[model samples]
Target: MLHYAYGAVKKSMEAYVTRTGSNLLEVPLPFAVKSNDEIVSEFRKALERGKSNGNRVRLNVIDHVTSMPCVVIPVKELIQICREEWVDHVFVDAAHSIGCTDVDMKEIGADFYTSNLHKWFFYPPSIAS
Candidate 1:
C-alpha cells in the first residue's frame, strides 16, 4: 500500500512537471549531524539561487521524514522562507506525523498535505482493505 501511494505521488509529480515544465529539486538527506539553522541556511541558499535565475517556484514539497528521526523542520520557518522566496504552493507529506505530533495545516500555511493514519494511529486499512 505504501508502494502504491508512493507510485501515485511520483506519477502526480511527473504530470505536474510535464504540464508546467518545471524542474524538481529533490532534497538529499543530510550526511552528518547538523543544526536546524544550518539546514535551513543551506536550503535558503538553494532557493535564493533558483529565485535569481528567473525561476518561479510553483511548489515546495517537504517530507517530514519522521521515520528518519531527523530534525523536524519548524513549519513557521519553512512557511516564512517559502513566502520570502515567492513560492506559489507548498505541500508537506506528513505520513509519519499524524498521530505523533500536532499538525495544524492551516497554521503551517501549506497548500496541500497528506498522511497515512494507519501507520501511526492504528486505523483500519482503508486504502488497502
Candidate 2:
C-alpha cells in the first residue's frame, strides 16, 4: 500500500498502518508544488515503480485535504489514475473535506471514503461519517 509522505498524513492513519503491520510505500507531495497535477504525476510514478517491480499497487490512501499546511489534494484525479492503473483499492481520508469543499462520492470513485463531520460541520467531537 501507499501513503503520503511526512507532514501530509494524519497520525491516526499512520498508527493504524503500524498496528496492521503493513509495509508502507511513501509518496512525497512537494511542499512547493506548482500545481495539483504535480502531485498527481508523483502518484503515477509511484504506481509505475511498483509495477516495474512486478507488483500491482494494492491500495492508495489519499488525503482529500492534507492536515499540515491545509492543502486540498486532487483526490478525484488521483482516484481516476488509480482506477486506470488497476490499483486494488483507494481509501480517501476526507477528514477536512466536508463543508470546506464540494464533495460528490459517486464522482470521486474511491473504494472507501471517510470524513469527520466534527471537523467542518460543527458536530460533536469524534463524530464522523
Candidate 3:
C-alpha cells in the first residue's frame, strides 16, 4: 500500500517537473514533524534559491503524514506559499487526510492532489484516485 501511494506521488512530481521545466522540487520532511513556521521558512528558502538559480520550484506538501499523528500543515499557510512567484506548482498528498479531515480542494488551491481512499475509507487497495 505504501509503495503504491509513493509511486503515485513520484509520477505526479515527475509530470509537474516535465510540464513546467522545473529543476527544483521541494518535499517536506517525512511525518512533517516541523512546526508551521519552520515549514514556511524552508519553503521560502527554496523559493529564494530557485529565483537566484533561474529555476521554477515546486512544493509537495503532505496534508497529514501517516507515520506521525497530529503532524499536519495548515491549509492557510499552504495557500500563501502557493501564491509565491517562484512556486510553479503545489502538490498536496492527502493520503491520510481524505476521509479523516475536512478538505476543500477548491479553497486550498493546489495544482495537484492525491488521496488513497482505501487507507481510511475502505474502498479498495488499487482504487486510489
On TM-score, the candidate that comes out on top is 2
Best candidate, lDDT-wise? 2
lDDT by residue for model 3 over 13-108, one digit each (tens)? 678678977653454443534577765666566556666756444564445444344555665575566585646566677777787778888877
lDDT, each prediction: 0.65, 0.78, 0.60
Q: Per-residue alpha-carbon lDDT of model 1 for 1-129, expressed as tens digits?
A: 011124456578878888988776654436553766765766677677567668777877665543444446555676678888788988777776676678777787777777887787678767321
Instruction: Indicate whether candidate 2 or candidate 3 has the larger TM-score.
Output: 2
User: Each candidate's TM vs. the true structure?
Assistant: 0.74, 0.83, 0.66
Error of 1 at 124 (Å): 3.4
The digit string of per-residue lDDT tens for model 2 on 1-129 reads: 334432545465567669977546777667776798888888888788767757767778887877666778888888989998898999988887898889999999999998888877789988979
lDDT of 3: 0.60
The runs of at least 3 residues in candidate 1 whose Cα sits more than 4 Å from the true structure, single-residue gaps closed, are: 1-15, 18-20, 126-129
Q: For candidate 2, what is the lDDT?
A: 0.78
State the lDDT at 48 in candidate 3: 66
lDDT of 3 at 50: 60
Looking at candidate 1, what is the lDDT of residue 85? 75
Q: Rank the candidates by TM-score, best first.
A: 2, 1, 3
Query: Stretches of candidate 2 above 4 Å error?
Result: 1-22
